[model samples]
Target: MSISTATVKERSLLGLKELSRDEIASILDRAAHWDRQQEKMSPILNKHFVANMFFENSTRTRFSFEMAEKRLGAQVLNFAAAASSVEKGESIYDTVRTLESMGIDAGVIRLKPIGLLAELAKKVSVPLINAGDGNNEHPTQALLDLYTMKQHFGELKGLRVSIIGDILHSRVARSNLWALQKFGVDVKFCAPANMQAPELAKYAPYVSMEEALQADVVMMLRVQLERHGEGVLKSADTYRVQYGLTEERAAKLNAGTIIMHPAPINRNVEIDDAIVESPQSKIFTQMQNGVPIRMAVIERAMK
Candidate 1:
């Protein structure tokens, strides 16, 4: 399941827009192989330097990227928003330019505003991987989640997957919808009235949480506390009652249906703490797959 370098001609991964199905499959397969043989190979044997520029607070994505690069024998420089020159009002362009001037191999960025990655991509000469951009997308997370699903179900096509929770502010939900739809999965979404995703018409929508939970795969997204300022949700308790996946709610899911989440989970907020540790949970595996998937992405971009 290795992707020959000859197969992927494009040298950058600014977005998922340019990839075809076979290319995506190849990448996922390669990632899976890397994950299984993590100790055996050092793909990035030379001291290649990779920079992580994260504007928003993160734990899983940042660490995952760092582990991925380092495991492949690359050096990693992590720049947190609070510690960086961004605190001095230096613009994103200047920060990226400064890093590029250091001769880094690639940049993994997680910014807040929509289209910021696109803007950054235009300015950087090296490969720019969009770790996240506002509520727009988290392509790497989506790739890992897709890879997790394929591992669980043995295929991607014809699988029914429902993404439930705060869609309006979740980059994970948006990316999952696109990746699932592209991979031929039947995608559905569930959220409270006010928290319904903005791009509803693009994918199947389930007005009730119950309906969405009936799918073969159920994914719960963490509620962004920042969205409370945007008037999207009134209170955490109210959101939990209306849309959270409680033990009773989990009972409604189809038998053996896989449940997933991108981490830093709010226990009893989006999903009950009990369910997160249950056998049905794939949330941790999703986090576990992040490393190899990211490694594959960096390797692909470097070529």
Candidate 2:
């Protein structure tokens, strides 16, 4: 079942930076083909069992990975942290090894702590796909996002993308930044004062929301209130005026500019309700693209 490309076929995709520009392009291209094949079933992982280990809650990522597994004609096992022996304080090593012992071919994991993926990967024989690890990375989400952009404009080179919101706390922001950087994209970071990612000083430090709106894509990130408490974020009205992708901001977008957000968008906060549903918004399309991109990843990971 091994593909000719061992680097992609055998290894797990923990971060977008692990792939070269060519590899990224290849995944995007493969995603396009997979998107076309959506109505059909692929026995790529027929009878193979894949476990979903979600230490943190998620709507799109968890279900999409499960759907991708089912779509590929594989059996899926859901690992519920609350229901399992994890309540007995069983270690992650024991939990993963216990699942691996049950004959899982691959495992998709999402956790709140960074470095868990690498540590767990070492403890089990199964291939590990990082759904999201703390504020560190979400490679598959980034892949689908890149595919969405590619679908719209046909290429990524020279494209300018502004990522606005909880920059320091968004795994989505980090993953997209890394992947987009490889494609020669003009990536900019924007966030409320303390929320900005200081690590991205090399990428224009921080741009005003108005300035960021001029880019090819104005990507919005959720305020991640869970990480940075409600007390830390501004009042809703003030935040809307300053950072929200409002109607005024959307109207000012240069032609060919698209609005994007990684979902569970904070209504009237990081983005306005109108712009989220507007013609210029690709927020929904990004979610739609997630399936095919994940299908490609799961299919490849089982190889």
Candidate 3:
């Protein structure tokens, strides 16, 4: 069935609270089906406009969102922090107001500092989509990740998923926790003592890397070097030993357990190159699914 045909509740997705479990499942299913049909069908037929405001550097997410919008026949306007009035100390609210005045249908924003997107969502008139908001959340990325896991494991219910490395500074980890919990997946967080997700017990249990590796899906997130000041990690070897997914560690995972990473991998650091390229790795699929899943989100939001 077409995404437009799905009965998504009438709500703005400022957070996951607006979506029911069934709505999330329907979106993912429609995304998968749309991915296959894009070769033959044009999903976005009418003219549309979408604005992408990125206050931080990005590669996969920014490009993937742009591609998704274009694939659905929407005109995309890119706003970079460096080129914007933020150089002159313009407030984020003012910038968002300026963009809203431009009459865009929706905005995809990535910002540093937690809760920035939520704050912006409060002011913007159009639908506000969080691309990545500091260490807070990247809802779409999490959605795509869940979609990838569902594809690999055949279902999300009761699947044990472990998210390892730099959890404190990762928006992906935060979003994944919410998404996994929403779908009834058993979730685990693995990171250094100082870098574990803040207030971990409030959401899900925190575990050591060893325990997390035992799960059916192992996700490794890149360390945000920008957030961690210079010389904080000391040495790559030290980080790798404590938190990296080495080949030996990969060998310990249960058979059919999927290895994943949200990309721009720090090879030999968070993941051994061999495991990243292995047969069980779904990292590439996660990246590939971004386009279709994002298309599904944009379509649903606009309607």
Rank by TM-score, highest first: 2, 1, 3
When 1 and 3 are scored with TM-score, the better candidate is 1
* Top candidate when judged by TM-score against the true structure: 2
Compare candidates 2 and 3 on TM-score and give the better one.
2
Q: Pick the candidate with the highest lDDT.
A: 2
- Global lDDT of model 2: 0.83
How high a TM-score does candidate 2 get? Answer: 0.94
lDDT of each: 0.81, 0.83, 0.80
Pairs that clash in candidate 3: none
RMSD of 3: 3.6
Candidate ranking under lDDT, highest first, comes to 2, 1, 3
Better candidate by lDDT, 2 or 3: 2
Q: What TM-score number comes out for model 3?
A: 0.91
Per-residue alpha-carbon lDDT of model 1 for 118-208, expressed as tens digits? 7777666777888988888888988999999999999999999988887877778877876778789998888776777656646766657
